[model samples]
Target: MKQDIDIPKVEGVYVAIVNEYNDIYKTQDWNAYIINDNDDALEMVIIVTDGYSEDKITSKFRKKIDVLPKKSYAKIELMQEELFAVNNQFKVTYFKGNTMYDKVYTFRKNTINLKALQPVPLMEARGVLVK
Candidate 1:
């Protein structure tokens, strides 16, 4: 029965941690985003995020999006500067058509700094993207 179960692979979806200027706050801040690079739309998307290290752990949070349009992205949350020293993890689950798929994206400790930014797909700003 295990072999008969078709667990579809998740593709073209990613989580990015971006450092951008916040107009309202008048400072640069790190933010998390969910990018849907697939041609098909995703429904009932959920993302659970947290940060942890050997001696410290941040609070866990969940975000739900009813629909993520094809080739689009949504802001999930803001990343505290101190959390960058710990491992940040994001578990993303969503439905494509009638099938379900999920994936976990992680940013290793001290790996989310500005020097590691790259051009993110479907987004004008650059950030650290995990595929």
Candidate 2:
């Protein structure tokens, strides 16, 4: 059935991030349709490896620019409308509001994305509803 085939294309993806405490954090179900809605939210997150984590990254949330995806060659890019220093933060954001072909959107469009998912410590990652 045509409908059945189309259903597989509309699924969401998962991406991951690590907080200042070396704890991981995962994003919500990033639906393809929904990814287009938010601009202020972080589009790209930095993958802090064990090798580079000590220098560019800090144990305390030290204004680090999260990485997601990036252009092949660029020094500075706009993310959440903020001018983030490329030196401190290795992540990169899109430059256009209407167009979404940059590295930021590529990771978002993937059917199974890893950039959006955050892997945090189970004890610390648990949620507490305020309502």
Candidate 3:
């Protein structure tokens, strides 16, 4: 029964968009990252990301990470400036110990700008985070 199913609340994991300088390109770039702030390692992490709006939709990007250790972060992708006009989403799934956990993180249209950036947990840089 639906009421009998055990769905644990997801915590300590977050998706953030950070603005930083690129050494090779010599320009500031917008990038997405997955932060794991838990004490235990996450296994078989999968992320499906995309951006969309009523009139425009970006391509779907699927990323997989075999393992993400505690208190670490990984760069997911470099986001172009144009993509920020639409709503961006990251669907995340992973296993902690024997339990499976999942969550959807979304950045609303025009909300990924520098003005919205804040100190991201477990990361040194500041950026916008899905609340």
Q: Tell me each candidate's TM-score.
A: 0.94, 0.15, 0.94
lDDT tens digits, residue span 1-131, model 1: 87986768889999999989999989999999999999999999999999999999989999999999999999999988888999999999899999989888999999998799999999999999999
Query: How good is model 2 by TM-score?
Result: 0.15
Select the stronger candidate by lDDT from 1 and 3: 1
lDDT of 1 at 71: 95
* Local distance difference test values of all predictions, in order: 0.93, 0.23, 0.93
Q: Write the per-residue lDDT of candidate 2 for residues 1-131, one digit (tens) a residue.
A: 75643222111222222212222444242211112122233343322211122234322121223332322211122121111111222222232323322222222112122333343322233211110
Off by over 4 Å in 2: 1-89, 101-131
lDDT of 1 at 38: 92
TM-score ranking, best first:
1, 3, 2
Q: Could you tell me the lDDT of residue 106 within candidate 1?
A: 92
> Per-residue lDDT for 80 in model 2?
18
Clashing pairs in 1: none
Worst 10 residues of 2 by lDDT: 77-86
- Tens digits of lDDT, candidate 3, 1-131: 97986758889999999999999989999999999999999999999999999999889999999999999999999999999999999999999999999899999899989889899998889999874
